[model samples]
Target: MASALDNPLLFLLVLLFPLSAMAQTNGTISLGSSLSTSDNSSWVSPSGYFAFGFKPVADKNLFLLAIWFDKVPEKTIVWSAHRGNLVLYGSKVELTSSGQLVLSNNQGQEIWTAQVTTGSATSAAVLDTGNLVLLNSNSGITWQSFDHSTDTILPSQILDMGTTLSSRETETNYSSGKFELRFQTDGNLVLYTTNLLTNYLYNAYWSSGTAGTNSQMIFNQSGYIYLRQTNGSVHNLTLGNIVSTRDCYHRATLDFDGVFRQYIYPRNWAGESWSIVWSVPSDICTAIAESIGSGACGFNSYCILDYTQRPRCYCPPNYSYLDSSNTFKGCKPDFVPQSCEPGGSGEEPRPQFQMTELPNTNWPMSDSEGYNSKNEDECRGRCLGDCLCALAIFTGVNCYTKKLPLSNGTIGTGTTKALIKVPQGNSTSQFPFQREMCFSFLEQEGI
Candidate 1:
């Protein structure tokens, strides 16, 4: 009944009440406050869908400042800072008054920082869209976690030129891994691996094959990942049936296995796991040679698709695992290397290196020489004559002579034959099919 124009005080109180409520719901972390991994301090978004805090690296004492879906069963991390540089258990991520977001280890050593120098009043907030932003006094975002992604690209995030998504070292290790999904300056979306230290060497395994002056990749709200050019043309990168549903959260990630895949999280379900919507380099074996220095299985070994559709490494006959604990370290010769010169005493005649033919086997890299019309016999003879040639790969009339440390070897359902040189011995005559079965059995038993 107090609808009179004189009720100005009541109207002002009603307007300010919503503003105060909105501020409370936004969940801002004021300057001088810090988030600690030991205390499990975090900033949760208004809807409680996303949270930003320090997550422990598996069972290790190290931690990483990360953002993840709060309600997910696994707490799937979408972005991280200082992933490569881990901090101690008591590490703190502080938003300083100077507008810098700094991560300091237990001893007060700086692990990483956003380096924002906006000397104004700033606050950090986790938005419902999953972006953790540092906002200036004018509500302008000075820095955001979406701009510096670790391995995932959430919906509405733009991956501009020069931005890259690097996979974690392993499923449990948050350190930088070997795989990279980068938006190159040449406008091509390339996937490659970097060499260790010093002068960096890149081995590109996959590319978008497009060239433009300026290009940007984005994960739109419609669940489609696309590359947009400066001229307004768009190209879809993910061609899967990802329906844009309200309860689904979509992300494109560079998986640790050197594969770029799009996954969908059904938040509405009680215990639903992330589902793969699409993947690049559908065949893992094809991308093995795209790594730096070695293949998917390292050196002196071959890769094959196991019954579970995963890549498994195996050594040919007469070779043993270099590191039995880790097969990716490749294999080593179980017998002594055959010397070209004659041996003394009753050492008998110098053992010759014999070829063990493996059908459906292929090695992509390290082709010293090849012939278009050569037969398998000629290819074998060429390798035997050349001291540097360690293996010969032949498919139809095409021959590829590989040197030692044969990389990217795979045994698929093709007609290719990989002739591996092994020490000539009575016990080495049988093919190593039993060894393959053993490896498969071990993998199945989670050994």
Candidate 2:
């Protein structure tokens, strides 16, 4: 664990500003040269606009060996190596005399190595285009950062077919997230939400639909982003007035919220955060509709597009988030579930539950049952009587009941009003049984 090239975290970079940028120690690194977290040094591009070295991740104690835009005075990492395993204080990234670039722990055990499949590297450079490269004796690139993308692609970079860019786990976490932007071998550029911890793909949330051979996703020097085919055809990905690279810095990133955005940072900025000029599928909360898995937000939570067009999760009334630190973790009801068992009289237990009204809210998945209902009160009664019913959608005509742990919840004016059933007082402490015991009983195993 170790840190930055003097970067002060920017609130907009999704980084908290507790740690400041590191002291600048810029230059071309020759073979056998090394940069260590202990010294807080970095190899800066000739224009001094970008740097290659360690930057603070979780804190000053833990660092990510990566590259970032230098002049912004904030470490907005565009590319990184070994994100799953972070380096510590005194750790170093070395260009061995044998020409291999290796990252070693404080104990000198190699932890990460650059895949330098080309000729032996003679030197290394941090390029103004925001690419870090290992150079051959003749200055040819043996390996480059732009070729091995993390999440963001800078102007002049190409996302070659079959290459993928995975979003960070969260705004503050650098590990890979659930969203991915892949330039498929079929020549299609698709945005997907991956099943966490596995490479298994769920469904395409967005795509260019330009399936062919040898298609490349390019963020050109002129500030145009598009998919270029080998046959000289093109599909524009970004739409806006072209901002010259001479006046602004450009980065197309797959944000943690599952949106792919093109950001512009002015060269002569005056305390302004990066601006988003364009984004695909502008409203992810509505765009990420799928039959399987939770919607844009996790289970039991509704999703909406904030003013900035980012997906934000919210818990329904009488429920709370499962994890405060991560809204993507979804929500849980604060009250105990009503018991589904039959009362001693052999009748359904209806008196213990009541309904709460949620207008224009819907859970598209987990429909337990559906039927015609004449009025709101009847729809409410239908859900309250069925212990398995957690929510009932009343569309002014028919009623659709949903079960627990609801998936694909959406809150919008176009959706129907939903009546959620909950225990009358909602205080499990009043019951004779312990909460854990009640939970087991509510799960429908045995008393």
Tens-place lDDT digits, model 2, residues 1-447: 324434445433535321212212344677767788987777888788998888877768788888888888565788888864687788988889888889999889998888898778887888889998888989899999888888899999988788998999888787898899989999988899988866778899898878874568888998899888888888887775778989988899998888999988888886547888899887888777777778788888888665456677877767878888999878898877877766687675545778876778788777889988768888888888788888899998889999987887777786489788766766322222134345645654543
User: In model 1, which regions exceed 4 Å deviation?
Assistant: 1-26, 117-121, 287-292, 306-310, 320-329, 346-355, 367-389, 394-401, 423-447
TM-score of each: 0.80, 0.86
Query: By summed lDDT, which 10 consecutive residues of candidate 1 come out lowest?
Result: 17-26
Q: Taking the tens digit of each residue's C-alpha lDDT, what string does model 1 give over 1-447?
A: 776356998777766543322334548767776777677657788888998887877556877778888988889888888765667788887777677788888988887888564545478788988998888988888888888888888888988889988887766667777778889888899888765454264667888887774478888888888889788888888784676847687888897767898888887876757887878877767675652376666687887766655566778777788877667667887866646564689877766777788888777877889888457788888777766677788887788888766777777786888887776653353446556767778977999
Strongest candidate by TM-score: 2
| Clash totals, every prediction | 0, 11
* lDDT per model vs. reference: 0.76, 0.80
TM-score of 1: 0.80
